[model samples]
Target: QQQVKQSPQSLIVQKGGISIINCAYENTAFDYFPWYQQFPGKGPALLIAIRPDVSEKKEGRFTISFNKSAKQFSLHIMDSQPGDSATYFCAASQQTSNYQLIWGAGTKLIIKP
Candidate 1:
């Protein structure tokens, strides 16, 4: 499995500010990379995802709009709030690699009041 590099080991975002997390992978064989958000005392949950062919995907305030050509992806949190503070992870997987995913070193996001 190829490693996915995520930037900004930690992030501090003010309320209503935009929080952006970035990730890049070297394996072009990796089909899709998904962003997961884990709140305290809770397991990680899928926030959003982008298909290999698609450049972007958005849901509510979270976006996984990506640059497939560069094998880079991002999660954008618009109107960030304290409630949004959590550990965010980016994961990559290959079609033939079964369900096993290569995870990025997560970024701890703090949305300040």
Candidate 2:
């Protein structure tokens, strides 16, 4: 079974709008949750991450809200711009097995002008 699940395979937002992506995990052992953003040719880059100890984290226009009890997390982008259009992925990792990350099917976001 897939350890992590994400919703809304694709999304479209107007410029200066908000974009949201959500994820859920089945593995309770997962302690590290991270979001990645990738362009067409470049490798995925870490956008933000949160540990079980924190409920939410925000950096600039990006925010990550986590619900430990629900084993779920969501990423929110505020004031999304055209440049923000990209594929976003949610991942979970634990201390076991060298902390290998279990990836979720990515969400492709398109920001319209």
Best by TM-score: 2
What would the per-residue lDDT of candidate 2 be over residues 64-105, giving only the tens digit for each residue? Answer: 999999999999999999999999999999897589999999
The Cα error of candidate 1 at residue 43, in Å, is: 1.0
Residue 15's lDDT in candidate 1: 99
Q: Which residue segments of model 1 deviate by more than 4 Å?
A: none
Report how far residue 91 has shifted in candidate 2, in Å: 0.2
lDDT of each model, Cα atoms only? 0.90, 0.95
Estimate the TM-score of every prediction. Answer: 0.95, 0.97
Per-residue lDDT over 1-113 for candidate 1, one digit per residue giving the tens place of the 0 to 100 score: 38899988999999999999999999888887889999999999988877788887889988887888878899999999899999999999988889578999999999999
For candidate 1, what is the lDDT? 0.90
